[model samples]
Target: MHIELDLNQNDLEALLHHCQSFTPASGDSREDGRLADALQALTEALLEANASQ
Candidate 1:
């Protein structure tokens, strides 16, 4: 299944940047991890909905 992301370019770029900061070798970055988790959950939900169709 495929999913189309409907986010503004700036917001998406910001999110990508935020997630980039959460690397395992980086600083104690739980906050960025939360952001990444939320993004993944949201994407999964969107993709699952399309798969259900």
Candidate 2:
């Protein structure tokens, strides 16, 4: 599946903030680690994509 979003600068900033501040509600270390990793990846990708725009 493919998804696309059209976000303004402020919206991008807000989404980035959420990605940075996210904490998994589950106490499982493995699950939390995966979630954190995914968020980090997303943050990096978002920053890179934003910079390229």
Candidate 3:
């Protein structure tokens, strides 16, 4: 699945903050792992976008 979002500085910061704040109990579930991976990917993409700007 592909998703697209157009986030400004504040939006991106909020997203990063939320992702950083998230904690999955025990970190043992498959869904939790997937969410963690997605968050990491999103963070990397956001960093790359900022670097290119």
Candidate 4:
């Protein structure tokens, strides 16, 4: 499965902010790991997109 989003600069910023502020519930190591990976990927993608603009 795949998903796509067409986000403007503001939207991307807001998403990054929200992801940065995310806190996983206590004792949920799996979720915490997933969130961390997602945050890293999102940050990288945002940086790459910004650089190409």
The per-prediction CA RMSD against the true structure, in angstroms, equals: 7.5, 1.7, 2.3, 2.2
- What are the per-residue Cα lDDT tens digits for candidate 2 across 13-41? 99999999989879899999999998998
Once fitted onto the true fold, the runs of candidate 1 whose alpha carbons sit more than 4 angstroms away are: 1-28
The model with the greater TM-score, 2 or 4, is 2
Locate the minimum summed-lDDT window of 10 residues in model 2: 1-10
Model 3 steric clash pairs: none
Each model's lDDT = 0.59, 0.90, 0.80, 0.78
Ranking 2 against 3 by TM-score, winner: 2
Which residue pairs collide, candidate 1? none
Among these predictions, the greatest lDDT belongs to 2
List TM-score per model, in order. Answer: 0.45, 0.81, 0.73, 0.68
Q: Which tens-of-lDDT digit does each residue in 1-53 have in candidate 3? A: 66667889999889888777787666569988888888888887777787787
lDDT-best of 1 and 4: 4
Pairs of colliding residues, candidate 2: none
